[model samples]
Target: MRGSRVLSATFGYLGLTVAALFFLLPLLWIVVTSLKTPEQLFQYPPRWWPEHPTLENYTYLFSKMPFIRYSFNSLKVAGLSTIGSVVSCSLAAYAFARLRFAGRTALFYVLLATLMIPYQVTMIPVFILMRSLGWVDTYYPLIVPWFFGGAFGTFLLRQFFLTIPTELDDAAKIDGCSAFGIYRRIYLPLAGPALTALAIFVFMFQWNDLLTPVIYLSDPDKFTLTLGLAFFKGTVVTRWNLIMAGAVISAVPILIIYLAAQRYFVQGVALTGLKG
Candidate 1:
């Protein structure tokens, strides 16, 4: 029995290691490719590691374009979007979970139905609205819509909120706390895991968003990292090395955020749907 258990553990570890390598090899290759020169990029037989790694590609990327500005723009839009989504979604979720109102369930179901409607279906209409409002070519179109909350975020948070005991709400009410006060003091503090998870989701979406930025923003100075990376492909030739470098740079903040909130993220996902 002990021997069988040992063999099972060994196989489990081996399988996990193989899975890790499967996902990591591409990222490793991107990092390696970013350091190679133009000549090494298209060698007859590709090199796993560059003979002489260089920072020239990264330097060229920064000097040739407003890469720093692009980074700042991405950060600004992602940060604001995350903040807006978290606040708006949490408030909406609280209402759906706790408040008594006519047609509350119907309204939530409508919101969920919206999630089934593809963004492509509304893309043209939304763009026309933005254009009519004179928001085209501005960050307003990129950042403002998120303040209204989203279906997925509301649903996720509402599920998590429902898991919390209503006795706490009664206790808060006994203390003469208003509905807003109960949410701010009790629910918000206890919903940390769900909030972190939602923030990470919203931030990642905004950070990697290319289509919205392309549709709304034409100014080079306002380009986000994803849009800026597209500039590396010229009509005549593409710079793979520079593109890889930009990809690495764009991936850093996401890695940092995931690592920082990984604990809460896992817990949030685990506990969110326990009740419903």
Candidate 2:
């Protein structure tokens, strides 16, 4: 029995290692490619390790483009969107989870139903509305909609809130606490993991979003990192090395944020659906 268990564990570890490598190898290649010179990048046999690694691509990327401005723009949009998503979604989730009201379940179901409709369906209409509001070629279109609570964020937080004991709400009420007071004092404080998870999700989404930015933002000054990266592609010759370098830079913040809040992210995901 011990021998069997040992063999099972070994296989499990082997499988996990293989899966990790499968995902990591491409990222490694991107980093390796970013360090290579243009000459080294287009070598005949394609060297895994550059014969001569250099930071020329990164230098060229910074010198030729307003990379810093793009970074700032991305930070602005993602940061504001994350804050908005957390505040709006948490409030909505608190209501759904704790408030007693007519049509609450039906309303929740209706919100979830919207998730089934793909963004592609509403993209054109939303753009038209933005254009009419004179928000085209601006950050408002990118950041403002997120201020309204999203279905996914609301649903995730609601599930997490449901897992918390209702007795706390009752106890808070007995202590002369109002609904908003209970949510602000007890629920929000205890929901650290869920809030962190939601913030990370919103930040990552807004940071990496390409389609929405592409549609709304036309001016180079307002371009996000993803949009800035797109400029590297030319009709005649695309700069793969520069693109890879920009990709590495863009990925750094996401990696840092995820690593920092990894514990909360895992805990939030694990606990969210426990009661639901």
Q: Clashes in each model (backbone N, CA, C under 3 Å)?
A: 0, 0
In model 2, pairs of residues that clash are none
* lDDT (Cα, 0-100) at 270 in candidate 1: 65
Give the number of the best model, judged by lDDT: 1
Per-residue lDDT of model 2, residues 1-276, tens digit only: 999999999999999999999999999999999998878877889989997889988777788778888999999999999998999999999999989899999998998888889989999999999999999998998989888998888988888898899999889899999999999999999988788888888888899999999998888899999888876565216668878898898899989988888886676566545534
The TM-scores of all predictions, comma-separated, are 0.93, 0.92
Q: What lDDT score is found at residue 107 in candidate 2?
A: 92
What is the per-residue lDDT of model 1 for residues 1-276, given as tens digits with 9 covering 90 to 100?
Answer: 999999999999999999999999999999999999999999879999989999998887788767788999999999999999999999999999999999999999999899889889999999999999999988998899889988888988998899899999999899999999999999999998889889888889999998899888887888898888776455216678878888898898889988888886676566545534
Task: Sum up the clashes in candidate 1.
Answer: 0
